[model samples]
Target: MIAPVVSAPTVSRGVRLGYGVGSFCTATVNAVPGLLLLYYMTNFLAVPAWLAGVVVTAPKAWDLIINPLVGRWSDRTRSRMGPRRPWLLAGACTLPIAFFLVFAGPPLTGVPAALYVGACFMATATAYALFEVPYKAMPGEMTHDYHERTSLLQWRMIFIGAATAISGVLAPAIVSSQGANGTVGSYRLMAATIAVILLVAMFGSFFGTARAPMTGAPEADRGGWREQFAAIKGNSAFIWITALACTQMLAVSMMLAAAPYFAAYTIGTPAATQTLFAALVGPMLLTMPLWVRLSKRFGKRGAMVLAALLFGGGTAAAVATPLFGPLYAHLTILVVGVGIAGVQLLLFSMLADVIAADAARTGKRRAGVLTGLWTAIESGVSSFGALIFGVILSLGGFIESEPSTPVQQPDSAVTAVLIGQTAVPAVIIFASVLMTLKYRLTPPVGPGPDESG
Candidate 1:
């Protein structure tokens, strides 16, 4: 049954700006690794394709354990700054340090390199979890207005898309100009800058939002680890959405991981490749407002479905780019970017809706738990995607010592790599469409009892 919509309290302009800044900061953290880590490892560090993937993927797998623990702990946390804020602060402070370590290029020879990468990645991922989970949880508690939620998310996504565009586009250029030796330095500086920005935004949100008084069975509602697992198992919609998120993230990660290779080999020049990569993400930033409008008109689900179709169609069309020339290829990728823009913006909105639905049904706010589970799943799926792409590159005989001469690689291997980049992800995104169909939760009503907390 469709439940009555709850009116959300009006949020001030300051709160709105705070939310946007917070989102921007969080998104900058997310965008850096996904867009540039693979490129750094493969191109700059001389990490082997297979090992590069392992380094990229392993830390996310660690999140399977870390995300939930943080979520549950936050759920039980009671403090003046609010349950979610302390972690947000702690995470913000730690992130730059951890991030600096990840990109600092620690010694790598045998097990030491592998271990170093893993350890650094683990620290970075943990810091992200602390910040991201709580940051995501705050919106639901801030206001219950359905449209207000959408408006808040819209602003968050704007900053998110903007941050992603700037970071994704600029990071490669920075790394490239600095040369391999300077790559670590560039990253360190970037991390420091981003960290300060994120800290400010996080604090702004913490201070700006009105903390809804938590009256009901506070600490008791904070379920144990076993109960959290059980809750995840029980919530069909959350599970399905998470699975869809995982699949989409995998596809996106694979594409981002392989973008440099595609640019260097398929397109012919690293300079050209960087421009192409910009083309891939550039339109996304410009058209975010359009996607936001579309979502409002079509509803988040409809917008998502449309995004999957366009993204899949564009990916498939990209396969013909060899015959079509770079111009057409760029155009096709641009179209794919547009599709990605919609998906990227809408997905979080839908997630917020799901969380709100769950709260309404249960009369409990466990946004931290839900966001944690989602982020955890996303981390693992994304890591697996990177790992798979790394393996594909290795098996295809792609090398980092010199630019790939596409003619040298066997046609069959090249075909496999291309399929992994374009076709496989397209299929995964298509499958994700099906998963979303099962997400019956809507923003107005909150989640049903059957929904996962």
Candidate 2:
């Protein structure tokens, strides 16, 4: 059954913060796996690049099926604690365990090791879908106000950036610090720590949003997955925005997979990988308000256009790569950082609106189902980031050596790293600008897009 939109009667700051902290879990799972899993498999475990990519991407095909099922289940659930939080709590408890095993591997080598990673990663991806699908659904149910939705997402993104820095950078640092990069012990220790953090943050969001309302009463009329899919198909804004988000995630994934390589070959400080990332993200943290203001003033699409321009410019600048040394390199990354901050900050808020609009248009409250697709696309694209990196490396003939030792890549591979980090993303992101230009979503409909064109 469709329900009338209901904005929050009162949304406490604590509730906002609690919800935001859940992103730490999201970022840890997303960033850590994206950043290091490829490195661990290819470089440390002696897995071939192409096969490693298959191990990474195949699980997400499973996620495409699992995400919608989980989403629909949450829609049908009738629980006092709310449909989303119970699942969030479940995911919080179990996700880290699978995450630990992804890195832990079995006590074997080669194909056996590949099987272990693929199996563990599938488990981890499922656990992520459990929390994230429902969690993504929450904002639509939690509030209907345009500005308020943006505020909630702002808090979430702050934690997301922090988690990216910690998970992406510090995890690699921990592995390298162990005297053997990506060593079994190093990954075990790192995974355990990340799992603990995921638990605290997920549980925090669960209890924090405990008092929030559901989207509607169990979606009685259009309760099936077929109905949910049809509802989403009606929303053009969601479609375009989803397209944009997928590409952005893919571009970001390529860079993340290439970060350590860029640092090693381009920046020439392999051990300072975390510091390099910090420079990119630190400005993102400090400059978020500017993006907030841009969205408020210029409209979200305009702001996204601005972000796309900055992203392109930064990627183009990356061609300079230490020619002007560390300062220039850092500044280029900083520009990219500011650009990404806008996308991350504005896009999720946009999705919440899309879900709301779909509910209103189709007269079926199916935020969970929509969000499941949203999260599924996100997780799937993220895994493909690794696949893309591995393909680029293989096509470029990248070398893998002992994690503790220096292995200089061939000039062709070095060029591939540069292309992955810069050119491919630049092209893909520029295309997003076209999609953003077509978006005209506003409060009357939602924040993502409303234009029939």
Candidate 3:
């Protein structure tokens, strides 16, 4: 028989803010690498585009193993600080240092440079899994109210927007300030600054949710990996959402990886990277409330379909950037940003619902394991965005060069950048819209439980 829903208390404002703060770390770490790392490897370090893509993607492949293990480890921990916070603390301590090293810009080029960046990035990915897998699991355990989950994640979406905007604008601006071509010294400075931000945000989140609620009892030593996989396989909602999220992430990653090339070749200025990112994220800050209300009116599945259409449409229209110029590209990306707001808000909220419902049905603490698997696949699939874009660049004969010695890209390479950034992503995002149609879930409901002290 199915267990009754265990009503969870509402999260307090301070705690909510603290939990939301973690996105500063998650968003920056994700955004900077996706936006600049590929360009950095190819342009600054002279790594071939294909090899650079491999370096960026190879480490995230480790996530498939590490994320689930971290998840299981967190699920079983008996900590006074709670199951997830200790891991958050651990990630806070490690990730910044690892991140700093990824862009330290060692005095090396080509293969050696690729190896160095790869090793450092692997470390970053591992540290990230420690925090993100368990961190994602928290909302499910925090509350059982279906609508409350959306309300709680709204704060997360807001923070995501802010963090993404800051990182997106700041990183490129720092790099561009050194030179239109960008020097190694400039990247080093950007990495160090971003690392400090990561430290503050990760630690803030570690302490912020000190008194956050948990709806279910801990199930440490619950079964082995086989059991976890079986549980995940049984959940249709989990599967569909994971598929949908992976497709969306891949599209976003591709656009991020191609941004610098798009700015330099299509938009006619290296600094346009900053403006494009600004356009891509500005709607996130302004339209979050609209997305939230839309979810309420149409339901998440319906809203998700609408959002995907907007994203796909905007991305497709951006293909005309070369013909219409920078203004057209920015306008199109602004529309993409509006859709992104809804897409980001609804996906996490839906995941929380799925996890909460699973707990109610089975009386098991599976959030960690489930989230572990979800993050693993998400990270792995998203890495392909860079890989795919790299292959496109290679096919178009993109030349590798040092920052001090800039190379003129062939017209084919420039064309590849435009298509990879816009058309490919547009196709992929529309495919995600089709996947969204397959997701079906009924939110769990019950009387409210007593508030956590």
What TM-score do all the candidates reach, one by one? 0.87, 0.93, 0.96
Model 2 pairs in collision: 1-220, 1-221, 441-449, 441-450
Summing lDDT over every window of 10 consecutive residues in candidate 3, give the lowest-scoring window.
444-453
Model 2, residue 44: distance off in Å is: 0.5
Report the number of the highest-lDDT candidate: 3
Q: State, as a TM-score between 0 and 1, how close model 2 is to the true structure.
A: 0.93
Q: Per-residue lDDT for 47 in model 3?
A: 96
- Can you write out model 3's per-residue Cα lDDT over 139-191, one digit (the tens) per residue? 98888777788889989989999899888899888887778777899999999
Where is model 1 more than 4 Å wrong at Cα? 1-4, 107-111, 179-220, 400-417, 443-453
- Expressed as tens digits, the lDDT of each residue in 294-323 for candidate 1 is 767877777788887888788878777668
Provide backbone clash counts, one per model.
4, 4, 0
Overall lDDT per candidate, in order of appearance: 0.69, 0.77, 0.89
lDDT tens digits, residue span 1-453, model 2? 122335545567888888888998777887887777777777777787878888888899988889988887887777788777888988988897888889875565566778899999999988988888888888877776666677778888888888888885778778876773447788788887888888888888888887665434335334455655776676678888888888788878877877877776777766656876887677657766787778789877888889878877887788787578767877888888888888888888888877766666666567777788877877687668778878998899987654556476789888887787778878877877887876757654443433343
